[model samples]
Target: MLMALSAPALAHPHSFIDMQTTLVMQQKNLLALKMVWTMDEITSADLLYDAGSAGAGSEIWKKLAAEVMARVMAQHYFTNVYRDGKPLRYMRLPSEYQLSRNGNKAVLEFVIPLAQPAPLAGKPIIFSTYDPSYFVDMTYKSDRALHLPAEATPACALSLFTPKPNASMQAYALSLDKADAPPEEMDLGQQFAQKVTLQCQ
Candidate 1:
């Protein structure tokens, strides 16, 4: 049963990403989150090679971008925002989105708005990024990856939490195959996710 249960959790995470996120605020209210993701060299190389084969400035890039965005949308942009321990819903798709390449790396940028903007004057909030299926590992570039507005900086403090998976968990994650579908009851990726918290005065 353990092996059967772990089967689905073990299949996935074929890609890696380094992510940077900014908390957008308006008049002390949380408005949206701006995200920048840079894909690893091998994946980036594959994408660029494909793009080149399709021809420069070809429509294939556009189609690829659309497909990528569609997959991300299906996963709620791989984001989870919370206030007081309750999850916050997304109002809609990103206001702005683009896919591009910087040398050998593929980059993705977008902004996701909250369903209902929350006041940041007196409370705290948390956000995290992870692929539920564990098919992609999303990691912050550094401690400075989470940015806050100038005004919010005075009253708000930012903290990052990177979960360290134990040896057993690591082995379990390593056992997963890229083609495996995640089990509905298991959120294996979350166990190894990085979280950003904004605490306000």
Candidate 2:
């Protein structure tokens, strides 16, 4: 009976990343977000190899950085920000960004600003990061990866939540093809995303 069943092959993630984010606030008002993504050794190797072949100080690296930023911009930085349950909008492209090779890994850093700074006088804010297609695995390297500067929000508190998908959902995510967009009802990445909450007085 087992021989008679055919199971479709799934495309799993080939790249891994350790991510960190910092909430940027000014005078108790959320101003922007700072993010750092460090790619795993294998993935970084390919990028470094390409850069080397392009020659020393080649513009290829910068071009690659721009291309990468463009893709993430299309996906809204793979980020979701909410204040009091209302979604916040991105004011513009990343205010600052750079991509560089660090030893055996590649690191990307950028800052994304909000359309209008949200006052956190006494409100709660939620922020999450996930790739909707689940083509790449993004995880926080540690609890300390998420930061809030005390000077900007003296009375604010921060909490981090890292959720893992259950067996069924994990199986579903693993079976998805990279080329196919996940169905509307299936948010594979969201199931395993890291959530950051900020509460201020």
Candidate 3:
């Protein structure tokens, strides 16, 4: 463990989230992605503390969800989608969104509608989500984390690919402080995020 820590590659992630993604399909076509991000107890401590007095399904939860979602929107949802290496577009606002608590964790759920649904029966689609600066580590809990529409599963296959950052990239991520913002073009988050690929043929 010590040796691995001392290795040239280190990210020093400050916060962690267990993520799940659902591919919403219609007639074998991709429509939107339903995302759920569950923050660890320690990371959600402040939010939970603030909501300590608020009851479930109260306006407080709704208000907090909007506030957090606004930030997410400002960051392009901290997400990227592509088809055959070309970037895909998404609606500026999600059709549905909310924040809720489960047990000891805070959960964020949202659905990002595609500007135009793609035909999955024709090609593969790929996507990834992460914090560009590496301050927050976003990871899928497992292959099961990616839920597929039942109608499309028979003809589709899904896989999650966790990337291994090269030495230089790892060093750069580890050297940075939380206050620093990565350059937009670098797509620093992409280097460390787990990528999901969906194919239908």
Candidate 4:
């Protein structure tokens, strides 16, 4: 009998930031999202998000937020209702709202607000992302490593900039695939229960 050891990569859930998407009625005509990354310095960042027909921060922001948040939070997460970089409220898992850019090439070193599920806390979320209209590839490296076709690899992954006044949000859709699965899922519920038990001990 032959024993197979390694599993395929695509079989695992891709990791993207588990963020709560929401909207803000700020004076500026912009759209934005907030989420913490394992990297303290986001050398580059951008939202390959949608810009509905209206373009940029048009009536499209709210509409897209609602749509995207649903996809992200389907696994059980919530959106944070914020205003001008401060916490204003908390929307249930899968909240939607407007987005705005406060800075560029920003470096953020904050703690995650919520504790991850039993085995997910203190781990990293690998954001394997891609979009047709907008691209946000910060590394700007070849796609061979990611097992993607050269053409499929995004050229503008790091195109971090605020949306224009009359710009419509990118019409691209968002997909979230958890990166940490096999190694973690081995004993997920059990590991989580052990963590709780250890905490009480």
Every model's TM-score: 0.85, 0.84, 0.87, 0.25
* Residue pairs in candidate 3 whose N, alpha carbon or C atoms collide under 3 angstroms: none
Indicate which candidate wins on lDDT.
3
List per-candidate RMSD values in Å. 5.1, 6.6, 5.8, 19.3
The residue ranges of model 2 lying beyond 4 angstroms of the native Cα positions read 1-11, 53-58, 176-184
lDDT per residue (tens digit) for residues 1-201 in model 4: 000111123322112221221111122211223332221112123232233234446565545445444543542322232233344322344222343323332122112222222211122212222211111111212222122223323421111121122222111112212233223233222211100000000
Local lDDT at 185 for model 2: 72
Maximum-TM-score candidate? 3
Rank the candidate models, highest lDDT first.
3, 1, 2, 4
TM match of model 1 to true structure: 0.85
TM-score of candidate 2 against the unseen true structure: 0.84
CA lDDT, every model vs. true structure? 0.76, 0.76, 0.81, 0.24
Worst 10 residues of 3 by lDDT: 1-10
Better of 2 and 4 by TM-score: 2
List ranges where model 4 is wrong by over 4 Å: 1-49, 52-56, 78-96, 100-184, 187-201
User: Once model 1 is optimally superposed onto the true structure by TM-score, how far is the C-alpha of residue 11 displaced, in angstroms?
Assistant: 8.5
- Model 3, position 163, has a per-residue lDDT of 88
Candidate 3: which stretches are off by over 4 Å? 1-11, 179-186
Clashes of each: 4, 0, 0, 33
Q: Give the per-residue lDDT digits (tens) of candidate 3, residues 1-201.
A: 111111122345667778999999887678999999898777676677777878777999988888778878887888899988899999999999998888778888999999998888666898989877666778997899999887777889999999888999888877776455578788787688999999898
By summed lDDT, which 10 consecutive residues of candidate 1 come out lowest?
A: 1-10
